[model samples]
Target: MNKKDHSLLTRSFKNISVLFFIVVLLLLFVVILINVLFGIYTWDRLYMDLINALVGVMIPLVLFNFLYDRFTQQHKDRELSEKITETMLLDEQVIDRFSNDSKKAFIQKSTESILGKTVGNMVYDTLIQSYLSKSYQYRHHFKYYISYLGDKVTKTFAVDDETIFIFNPDDYYFVREDLSFERDITNFIQSNDVRIGFSYKESTLDGLYQRAEFMFRENLWVNEEHNSMLQELSNHEMEQFVKSFLQFTIEIDGEVVPYQVIHNEGYEGFHLLLDIPETLHSSVLSKVHIRFQMPQLRTQKKFIVMISEPTEDVEIMFMHLENEMEVEAIPFLNEAESITRLPNDTIKIDIHDWILPRAGVVFVWNDRQ
Candidate 1:
């Protein structure tokens, strides 16, 4: 072989080796960067780092993806808010009965998966509810469906032994928020004893994995137990029923959310402290809804609900003994100090002047139910 041909071959080999080495270095850098971004979560200064990174050049790719998604989601959410109703529809096949062990297992498994295996039981199970909540949100970057359709539109089903799917319209509001609203979810979880699990519908988009899981959560559902008594009026057998406390059945959102509200004393008239589901727009502290048979009182005709702390908006509603019975609540003054008379027809307490916590009179009118 000629000297020139040998020299050309040697140079080609060196160039090829250098190019391979460069490619390997670039690939290794990419892998390390991804691991650093995803795997390295610290207890300290992590949030500030994210906030600073959200700007132009330094923004993390995962953060950018989530931010872009949530930004575009605002439009969809606006449409959703108008279409969706505020209340939840309870499904007939909803699974309410769970063995104690089953309940514990659900809670344990749920917390562990979202909060990571190393998180302490006390942290996820008990205190720092908000922390666990953020962890739950961080578990994925996707969305799901909720049951409630809209206001003035409610439909119940009667299924045989099938799973009853109780869902809130607000569930979609929180769940689809992506990573932008992780702070809010975190705060909510910390305050609320929220243990959440999922139900799969077995469908997906990107791959074979299930996608559209119908979301549900736990809530305190009201039930009516008749406490009938004797009423003697001019040889009349008219029934006079004195109302008892509103019986609250702890429905854990079709066994998806395992939070059991432990009754602990709060302020003057606040007995509940743990939580309502994350789906609802209002906080647990603000909501004041009382349902009774509308006591057939012989003496008192009117009742006044007062607000001690003075809430900006409060709902005062009433439901009749008859299932078909519906009521329309009269709007009260806008000021928080102003009081409103309780009407028999009111069904929802979406807005209120204020529920005077000091007086804390939760009962309705004495004469007219």
Candidate 2:
């Protein structure tokens, strides 16, 4: 249910509960009042009067204990509910805090913080639906988190830095391919409440804040641009693209030299980047290899590279991934070409190579997944 409905139900529950208890309290008071007047006019003995006085005191004390216990739990439940509502409100406000650039980044970070470094359309969709299904997993934790209601509630909350986001952890069936930041966030918060209890943990707030702050200090979604496309580029284009993207520059003989990346005509697909000594600026002593296309968000496109000194004996030894994805070491040149995974899943390929250069080296791997 939505926040309004959830809150309204909570209020209704509280109001009815309180009204019922108040009526009981009033009945006891009326009885005492009636007895006092009757004893004042009808009683003839002090002993009888003393007994009535003791009875009046005992009745109020009983009602007081009953009301205190009931309201104590009621107050606790209300506090937890308020926190949950606050979390939802904060999430709604975040819709404006982010920009198009950081949207995917923030979502990936938020997802990774919970599900770890795993990527696939299936994994993302499953996690989202699992929270929305009737099998509300977090219900008990939220229900008993702040009160003694125990684990009767099946709803959950991802409490944040002064914000609370409701969640569900259960075996549910919901398969949606269009998994995105807004959709997932909305589904996570709009889930129906189940049972009645609470579970409080400081980490809950930490998780929510991590994502909320994604574009807070710096608007990540606004300015950060992601370039992930599969295409072939001529050597000249590759050089300019990679250099600009990496801001790559080198110092030669105490002076900074900007190197141009070139695709190998003989290899047909290898783009090379090396700081050419002014002497061998024409020689082929380049040091880097261009592999598969660049990656983005949670997509681990086949990003690979072979790096070694032209003077050293080596086969593909390194790769990088600045994103989330699973990559395998595929030997390109020879069976003896030992392969190793890249760092951070980021193979910074200058995919913008399509702008300049013509057929010098033919890029391999044209099939799309």
Q: Write the per-residue lDDT of candidate 2 for residues 261-335, one digit (tens) a residue.
A: 444442222222333334423322222211111112112122222111011232122232223223343433423
Give the per-residue lDDT of model 1 (tens digit) for 24-136.
99997786677668876543556566576676545577688899999889988987754432211133232235564554555666567677877855555654453334332
TM for every model, in the order presented, reads 0.20, 0.20
Q: How many backbone clashes does candidate 2 have?
A: 36
Give the residue spans of candidate 1 off by over 4 A. 1-188, 192-315, 319-369
What lDDT does the true structure give each of the candidates? 0.33, 0.33
Compute the lDDT for candidate 2. 0.33
lDDT measured at residue 123 in model 1 versus the true structure, 0 to 100: 53
User: Total clashes, candidate 1?
Assistant: 26
